[model samples]
Target: MSPPAYSRVLLKLSGEALMGDQGYGVDPAVVTRIADEVAEIRDIGVQVAIVIGGGNIFRGMAGSARGMDRATADYMGMLATVMNGLALQDGLEHHGVPTRVLTAIEMRSVAEPFIRRRAIRHLEKGRVVVFAAGTGNPYFTTDTAAALRAMEVKADVILKATKVDGIYTADPKQDPSATRYDRITYLQVLEQGLKVMDATAISLCMDNKMPIVVLDLNERGNMRRAIMGEHVGSLVTV
Candidate 1:
């Protein structure tokens, strides 16, 4: 196999991506499949870091909308992400891939606290570092955390794993005519109010010039193809 186009990459996975055909919570088979892909890229010399969301378990925004305290709901959401991190870690280790779960909220008994240097070190040492807890802040989404962590680690690109193959002009499921974008600019995403990432995340990437490759998570080999610089999904950049 050819060397990976990117030396280091930050993979952003939504909690829904882990749910498979189920309505809620993670599906073990899905997690194992993702682990296999991560191991494949690691074996080929790609340093991987992951920032996972918690919508499969809990979504703070949804909780808040249901008359719950925003901050408290968000904290619970963070804990959900930690659960996902541990699950992914278990899967990766099962595949014989060295892995670490670093949480922004500082659960030392379960996992290491988020330290910038420590995360980079873990990646350098050939360990997949899974960043959990979504920036340890209530207002911020995991999307922002992914962008922040990617820039902090100086990653070559952010591989955004979503259900759809790429960003569309509209909701593809709702609108059959919704078209896919092969490549798009950050400003275009914001101006059009596209659902790629939240505005904050998109703006952060735009300011820092961090590229984001949006690809389908359920499709086998899609992640590796994106990392190898193939035209497998939509490329989002300045």
Candidate 2:
């Protein structure tokens, strides 16, 4: 078989993705399914790194809007991501895939600290590295951390998994006339204010020339198909 199109990729997953129709918290079934998909890609010689968000358990912006201290709320949000990371690590390991959880906040007891070289080395050795703690700082979203980590790790692309099929003119669920774009440019996403990612994340990707494949995570085999360059979703580039 031909080699997969991407040797290394960063998967950006929202914590809400782990909730699986539930009100809050992770669903074990959902985690296992994602782990199986990730393991499939790894078995094909792909190096996978993940950066997960924390909107399910806690959302910093939501808390801040409700009168909590912004910084404190953001910190709590980061901790939520760490919990999701650990849960994913468990699922991955249960699938017989070697996985590591690295945190930006230096929780040596639960995970290794985020060292760029160490993260790369883990991937080099065929271990999936899940980055948690949101860049170890408040005020930055995990999307930005994903872009930064992808650049630092020199990933071939970013697989930004979402609920929708791909980038659309408007939220497909809300707008009846919305049309999906099979391929879109970074600038177009920013100029149009599409919700592909935050401006900071998109700008970072645009500056670094990192491509992002936006696909529906709930769709089975989509991640592997994207890794194989099968035109599985919207491509954001340049």
Candidate 3:
């Protein structure tokens, strides 16, 4: 087979993706499926690093909306992310793929602290690095964390795995008239308020001239196809 299109990629997986068909928390079957997909990409010689969100366990914004302190809620959300990181690590390792769980909150007992150089080194050595805890700060989403980590690691692109196959003009599930965009501009996404990613994350990628590919994680082999540059989803570019 031909070499992969991208040597390195940062995969942004939302916590809800881990829930699968369940209402909340993780589904072991979903984790295993994701692990298998990740392993396939790694076996193809593509360096993979991931930043997982904690929406499945806890959402800081949701808490804040319920009158809780925003910062405190965000911290709790960060901890939830760590829990997800561990789960993903377990799944990946079970498939014989070496993985590391690094947290921004400095949990020395369970995971290593987030170190940029060390993370890159881990990827270089063929170990997938899972960045958890959402930048170790409040008021930032995991989307922003993904962008920041991708830039730090100099990843070629960010693969944002979502439930939908690609970004649509409207919510596809609710609006049958919605259409998917094969390619879109950062300015357009911002102006239209498309939910491809958060504004902060989009701005970060735009400023750095980094590209993002939004694809459906539930689709079998979609992640591999995206990594291979097969036009699997919508591409957001400058």
Candidate 4:
């Protein structure tokens, strides 16, 4: 087999993606399918680290909109991510993939605290590290955490797995004339107010000269193709 294009990659998955066709919560079959794909990439020699969102179980912003304290709601969302991380870890382990869950917040009983060196070590040993807790701070999105972790671990790229195939001129679901962008710049994303990721996350990647590939995770094999450096999604750069 050919060597993988990237030695290390950070995959950003939203919690909603784990819901499959369900309205809420994780769908076991969907988690297992994603785990299998991760295992496949690992077998091909790609060091994988993941940062997952908690919108499926709890969205902090939504809670705040409904009159909840912003910080409290955000903390609740962080805990929800821990739950998703554990579920993902279990799925990966079931496929015989070594995995670890590291959290920004101290959750000694459930997972290890986030230690940059420890996370890098885990990757070096071929253990998939799942990062949970949105930087242990309120108001920060998981997208920012993914970018930070990717830089700390020196990941070659970030694969943002979402429902859409790529970044578009407009929301394809809502706009019939929306067009996908094969490549785009971080500045262009921000100037246009495109929701490829939050401004903070995009800025971080831009300053660090890191590339992000946005692709549809619901499509089987798309993740693998992304890791293999195929043109399967929109490439975002400085």
Candidate 5:
């Protein structure tokens, strides 16, 4: 399917999603599969910028709840993202797709520093850029980081790859009668308190007028469909 009107996009993937059903850390096989999907999308002509979370390995909130300091836990979470980013970079390269990993926190040994101009230049040259580390700070979620990077890269849309297909009225796992939205407005999402993404992340998108497409990453080629602006999931736009 032809994409609606996206020249470039930022994909926000949760780390736990990369773990498949194992519940913690990345499953190499799963990460490869995700990379393959991304590679396929890239082949179709979408400049992709990705922000991967570290919840699969460690979540700052979970660690802090267990008596770990919030800032330290967040830093550890950032490190986890670096590991995941490295794995993704390898996976994409193995598929013959040129990939670059950039970190908000400087990690010269592993990836390049996060520079907006450099990232755009790479994308222009047909390279996929993976953004790691959560905004180089604590007390923030990767979702916020994704929003930041999306804006910096001048992404046309935010493609949120989640476990569920789209935003639903209720938790589909818990409520059999839950209904999914085909499309939605930012105001409605905010007023309804939907949980597709965090308030801060949503606000960033709304303020920037960047549409967010929430689709299931488990479905093969769903990311491509989302980029094409097919009715794949709920589109949160102004």
Candidate 6:
């Protein structure tokens, strides 16, 4: 087999992806499935990092808009990410994959504080690192956090796993005419208003020249297919 397409990568998974069929919180089975996919790559010497969103437990922006304070809502969302991070770490470890969870909020007892250098060291040592908490601040999404962490860790690409297979011209479910582009320029995504990621996240990734692959994780084997550069989904590059 050829060498892995990337030696290091940052994977962005939403909290909802962990919900499996039940559609709430985390489903151990779903996390295990994801971990297995990751372990496959890990065994091949690919350094993996994960940044998970907290939408399944709580979306700070969504809650704040409903009456909660924006900052408080975002903090709660960050904490929720911590929960998801722990779950992911546990799931991965159960599979015998070495993993570490780092939190932006500095939860000493449950996890280590987010340290860029330490994270890189972990990856260098062949341990998967899960970045929790969204930038350790309010008014930011975990997507943005993923971008920032990707850049900080010098990852080759950011793999954004979503419900959709790829970036579409419009919501595929709502519009049958919507088309999925195999490759897209960041400029095109920004100009066309494609919903691959939030504007802030897109801007951060684009500014850093960090390539991204958007794919659907609900499908088995897709993640491995994606890491192998098998034309699995939309590729966003400058």
Looking at candidate 4, what is the lDDT of residue 188?
Answer: 99
lDDT for position 18 in model 5: 79
Q: Candidate 6's residue-wise lDDT over 132-159, tens digit each?
A: 9979999988888999999999999999
lDDT of 5 by residue, 1-238 (tens): 5554688999999989878889787788998898899898898888999999998888899999999999999999999999989989998999999999999999898899999899999999999999999799998889989988999999989899998999999999999999999989988998999997788888988899988999988889898777776788788998
Per-residue CA lDDT of model 1 for 13-85, tens digit only, reads: 9998888899899899999999999999999899999999999999999999999999999999999999999
Least accurate 10 contiguous residues by lDDT in model 1: 224-233
- Tell me the tens digit of each residue's lDDT in model 4 across 203-234: 99999999999998988999889888789889
Model 4, residue 112: C-alpha shift (Å) = 0.5
For each of the candidates, the C-alpha root-mean-square deviation to the true structure, in angstroms, is: 0.8, 0.6, 0.6, 0.7, 1.3, 0.9
Locate the minimum summed-lDDT window of 10 residues in model 3.
224-233
Candidate 2 regions exceeding 4 Å error are: none
For candidate 4, what is the lDDT? 0.95
For model 1, the superposed segments whose C-alpha errors exceed 4 Å read none
Give the TM-score (vs. native) of candidate 1: 0.98
Q: What is the lDDT of residue 161 in candidate 3?
A: 95
Residues 1-238 of candidate 3 have per-residue lDDT tens digits of: 7778899999999999999889799999999999999999999999999999999999999999999999999999999999999999999999999999989999899999999999999999999999999899999999999999999999999999998899999999999999999999999999999998899999999999999999989899998988877999899998
Error of 4 at 50 (Å): 0.3
lDDT, candidate 3, equals: 0.96
**C-alpha lDDT of residue 191 in model 6:** 96
- Evaluated against the true structure, the overall lDDT of model 1 is 0.95
Model 4, 132: alpha-carbon shift in Å? Answer: 0.3
